[model samples]
Target: MSFSPDRSQASEAAPVTGSAPGSASGAFAIATQGLSKRFGNRTAVDGLTIGIPAGTIAGFVGPNGAGKTTTIRLLLGLVRPNAGSATILGHPLTASPSYLPRVGALIEAPAFYPSLSGRTNLEVLARLGGYPTSRVSELLEVVELSDRARDRVGTYSLGMKQRLGVAMALLPDPDLLILDEPANGLDPLGIIGIRDLLRRVREQGKTILLSSHLLGELEQVTDWLIMLHQGKALTCGSTRDLLAQRGELVVEAGDAMQLDLVARIVSEADYVVTREDRTLHIACPATFAETLNRQAREAGATNLTIRVKEASLEQLFLALVKGDRS
Candidate 1:
């Protein structure tokens, strides 16, 4: 509801310029300053500040009710923030009309006229949004809906409908895309199709903000991440930096006594240790694996198998969320 623009002066704001991706300014496609949202007794988004670089795929992730949807709504200007401000392509939300035309979005489950054919439905949307009807065929092909273009929405499967929704979003040829759960309820093939489609979009030099519960699939396409928990940003940075910042060293000794000694020595070396039976999990740099093995041997711990294990994105997300709760 808050996305409504002040039509009179919305387009009068200085035309967007000088902030293109890779410019010396290092401008962002999306930027927020202390954005927050609340409803009655609950705070949905709290003091969120993040920047999404242009021409990159950014994953917006969190557990259920972590304010992922609310944050997306706020970013799109559909919902106003209680405090703070956001800019898309360097234009304030109030001036969104000037830039939103260049943005596309498919939030949650988009609805279509079940009685209409996929192509007809898109044509209706094109007319309503004042987009060129010529894009209908082009987008249908882009989303792989061309073969089913004449099929009624009611006869289409969930995956087909999702594809049609994406086609609808692309009718305007947007520069940035905001997709929420695009892979939800999709079968393996459908999921793979969406992944490939996203990759193609990125190859076209478009920026994308994707949110989903499918962490594995998300990891395949995202280069940057903004993780949320309990309505707050737990951590935000490039995916590589966050995952490579630390790693786990798993050590399994021959006996309980050896494990205990290993934990003590590792802790003394400024590493956090977790013990599970005869295994010691130490949170440290991968480079420290040799030090750990040598220390175990010096302490007479035989049959000790020490190996370095890198944390995956899923592991990193769980660890960050749990750490914040603690």
Candidate 2:
């Protein structure tokens, strides 16, 4: 997708001093340098540095125990870093008050009174947060909870509750929104609902930092990506550029002998090939698919089929983590 954040609605961003691989050149909504956090002897985050450009949806991707949550906490000031520094919306980390007002977050599961109606809940929160109650109806509509606005929270489904949580986070009309696993416990349709909602939110010129294990969904929506492993950032930059780095051509044959011959043809061409049953996975650019097909045919391999496949977020993450381990 295209990223075009309305600068008029966004804060004045700082000039880019450095760039991450494949990242766009612009001011960062969030930037960190050597940000670290530890609990006892276990390091939750280690020497992490990243830049999330202003007015884009950046995905926070990581496996279990990969410090994704810790990093979010540190960024939200729920937990302080052991070392390093960060800036949010041009304000230093130490000055959270200056930036927190313009920021909204839905971390983990959202909590609400079970007996209260969804609209009432938001109204209460808006009043307590010193925000006008007029935003309640608009937010309810935005989250698609207006139909169920009068229903008690106790009767709402998991998806409904999640949507309500999002509405709560958005009460302040924040410039930057942070969401952690908003799709958790949601069905496929629910997930799609959240995805559509996020795009609509982004259309208003707001920046979003989304953390989720749903890489496939993230791959579709995120303009930038920050991949984490074992308390460190393995990669951070544009999602398209990173995925473009790796691609494969799958060549299949009617028989094992033909597959071997096709594999040999690709291997002889100096492309790395992995044999799996009757398929040859050749590590090369998608553009090489035509050449591979022709070469396999020339090698007397009939009934050959070749398909170009791009590297998915899951594939890239597994490859990077494996490389890091090695």
Candidate 3:
């Protein structure tokens, strides 16, 4: 249950310094400054700076081709940065070649032998990585794969494979875990399962960097967020702080005609509205709810119900991205 390693070892002598510019010393599990990466004439990540504080589940989200993967690679030292630098577990990425052992990563779909049992696959990885064999069982239990430990990976579901991949990553008992698209192809139940798994990992005091396109689900599991648009950070802050920035009032009238009247009144008030059936969703302040109700009643909107709706992460992300492009 303990991930803290003895820092007295020579390989661990110089932990990542807290002296990086713009990063709060000793507050982050991962920190990057002006990080940039390029492929020939194309730029993938551009001046991306982020600070993920220690022991929190931080989400990395963006549209396709937004350089999320490249940024992850840069943090893992899988590729050299064209400009800028990063620190993982307090060790400068390029300087602390030995720091990788303290980190666990599943960058993409992990390859496993379909013919081998799940446990055997993990054993192979552990042996190759010089990880202790005792960890194989421990990780299997942690990922809830102990029941299927002896089953052939070929027979496992996509969710199972993803869970197995997580188990492999935990084989080293790393303090920092970086997962790219961990819930990429899961059903609703599978997504929730992974969410719960991540919660458990956080409870164990491990810092997790989860990258996924499923913003709604990602919102459920993360406390902090880093949203990328076109390889640049659109926003970075706590999940609640970002979502609470926007509020909406939802009004449902009795019928379509009532909705139309209500919409006209709200539009007259100079607020944007989106209609779904008999409900009008307005992105406005909560204080406007009373005014909307009064306007709806004055306009003869019967059976009207008004309530506040918090902006969802998807809504906020889309709005930010679109606003940036504009």
Candidate 4:
């Protein structure tokens, strides 16, 4: 895996991974150039080039077996890319695993000794990882586990355990945090807790790459998106670009003769209409959906159903994957 951070020299970063001097607009906190991974006859993640800007959240989304996990592993240097390279903060990812200190990752489900207290467990990991003891309290509070610090980790609920994993990742005060399904299997409160914690981390100018199968949850947190389908990057860009849809109104009436009359009134005013399923699929501002619904009644059109077909992330994903297959 070839990973370079946005920074100049990665070693300059404190205990963990170093920060890139120039901002993400300059080099991008996470850069992957043609990154790919393969397993014999099967290709898990193919030729992926993506960039995650610092201080923002980038959602890596896909369904089961979409290779989102493989990509995350490659970025963390746990698995080497077969074809391309990636860098974190300008430092080559495969060059040194120690550079990971600058990064905190919640990969897979993390576990601790069943008998260890949450606080002691963190203290042990923190000391072993070379992070200051001060980080333990800070992270426990961040994950909302401070109140249960003295309890045995095994006694904690699944939600608490997951939160503790997140706390461990945050121990080094990493600049780039990678979380894969951080909200999995949590209650509404736990999900909201993770969401709020990520927001706080982002506010501190930390960059986060959050991966999840829950599109709705990600839609709530990310400013950008890198959608993966069948191990390839299907679409990547600002969320606004993906969500924006454009078109016009086409009204359909059971009586074609009557509909033609209405079309002519607007056609003379420089408008065109097309008919679909005996209903007109028009090109018009979505704001006018209600207006058209009301206008069709006065215009002598009956049984008018205003169905707005706007493109959404889910829709776009389907189109891209289907397009690829075809």
lDDT: which candidate is best?
Answer: 2
Best by TM-score: 2
Total clashing pairs for each candidate: 0, 0, 2, 30
Model 3 segments beyond 4 Å from truth?
1-23, 249-307, 324-326
**Residue 69 error for model 3, in Å?**
0.8
Which parts of model 4 are misplaced by more than 4 Å? 1-27, 245-311, 324-326
User: What are the root-mean-square deviations of the candidates from the true structure over C-alphas?
Assistant: 11.4, 7.6, 10.8, 11.1
lDDT of 4 at 267: 56
lDDT of 1 at 64: 88
Candidate 2 lDDT, tens digit per residue, 171-227? 999999999988899999999999889999999999999998878989988988888
Worst 10-residue lDDT window for candidate 3 reads 1-10
lDDT of model 1 at position 73: 90
Comparing 1 and 2 by lDDT, which wins?
Answer: 2
Put down candidate 3 lDDT per residue, 140-236, tens digits, no spaces.
Answer: 8888999999999999999999999999888888899999999989999889888988998889899999998879987899988888877888877
Please give, for residues 64-181, the per-residue lDDT of candidate 4 as tens digits.
8889999989988888888987778767777756568789998878879769999999999999899898888888888888999999998999888888998888888898999988
lDDT against the true structure, per candidate, is 0.78, 0.82, 0.81, 0.72
**What is the C-alpha local distance difference test score of candidate 4?**
0.72
What TM-score would each prediction reach against the true structure? 0.79, 0.80, 0.77, 0.74
lDDT-wise, the better of 1 and 3 is 3
User: In model 1, how large is the Cα lDDT of residue 194?
Assistant: 85
